[model samples]
Target: MAKYVLRLFDDRIGVKAQGSLPAENRIIFIADGSATVSAGGGAATLAANSAFFSAAETTVTGGAEGAYVLRYELVSVPETEHGMLTGENIFSELLLNASMELEPGDGYLMRCDRVDLPPGGIAYTHTHQGGGIRCLLRGEFHVQTQGKEHVINPGEPWFEAGPDPVLAWAPDHKPGHFSRVMILPRALKGKSSISYVNAEDAGKPKLQRYTIFADEFIAI
Candidate 1:
């Protein structure tokens, strides 16, 4: 089995850091209070609804005041940075497994999934292939993809498909914690072409985010 080094504070408290990973991955939230990040311009305050993304580098401070965050690096099974499904690093608290699809298909297709976390349970820094749809059945969190973030509260559906992963993010988990994502395998189509039908320019990733596909409003 995979074991986490447990290097940082897993509970609610406070911490500081030097901005690192670029491309929107780190997520900060107001747990019981709030927090602020001191940057080149000024300090950005994070309250209950105010969250921060850590895709790029930026100086950050106290999660005190009520702000807290979970690096997808820390919350996963173990070595989630590598992005492998069959490994000991995957967390049971946030279980991710592959189940055979119910319909016609050759081999096996797997979807990214999440179980339940504790009070402060969170999932962060994930990637989705082109033409991917992420569904948050229960719970609340911001879905960060394509260099932007979308606050996906309970009963919301988000879709994205591109040559590269659109990017995936969410706050944390509580009761009935779960998430379901459907992605078409590259092997299915053979070639490595990933694109959205609504792309304004060929190979350009769209920025107009929506909670439903086309016109389908997913229910909570």
Candidate 2:
């Protein structure tokens, strides 16, 4: 399993996980703030623009403030099937493409595809079927799921399933925008998108769609 952590950078706003970089494959970079990461056999202090990869025997702890990190787990991305798109029109442009299985069985499994939405662009709800994670890379979307309505802004994500299937409308989704969602079977065992019961108090969601599926993602 690969662990994803967003060591708080700022007290208020969420500064992104630096991204769920990997421990084995992660860069272990301290972008803005400062922090201490356990390595080899002692503590190494990382400051802004400072990066290292010797935290094999250590864990990261916040200092006076916090640190932003981008983690990439070799076991997670390399083992699991993944596809990505970049630039203005990523999904629609088909920047990158791949296919995978959501479960052991072949049937009842969806293609697990990703597509981009242009401003005022609308993807039929039929395309939103199957279970996956949706991340608002940029801009916002009028997201309505399971009788609940809300706005998914940039740097935010949402998960959907049958019945209460999710629906997103860019009726107001801004431009130069991008969002990505990873589709997976909720039936899959192991680290899931299940949020902590006390996430609300913690002030951050359990899953980071664009990068990390969860702090501790399961492996096959």
For each candidate, the alpha-carbon lDDT, in order, equals 0.35, 0.38
| Candidate 2 lDDT over residue span 167-208, tens digit each | 456654363233233333444423333332233433532122
Task: Report residue 58 deviation for candidate 2 (angstroms).
Answer: 16
Model 1 agreement with the true structure over 148-213: per-residue lDDT tens digits: 877665544445443433433334344323333333443433332234333444344332222211
What TM-score do all the candidates reach, one by one?
A: 0.28, 0.35
Q: Candidate 2 at residue 207, lDDT?
A: 21
Question: Which runs in model 1 stand beyond 4 Å of their true positions?
Answer: 1-11, 15-25, 40-42, 73-220
Instruction: Identify the runs in model 2 with alpha carbons over 4 angstroms from their true place.
Output: 1-114, 127-129, 179-219
Best candidate per TM-score, number? 2
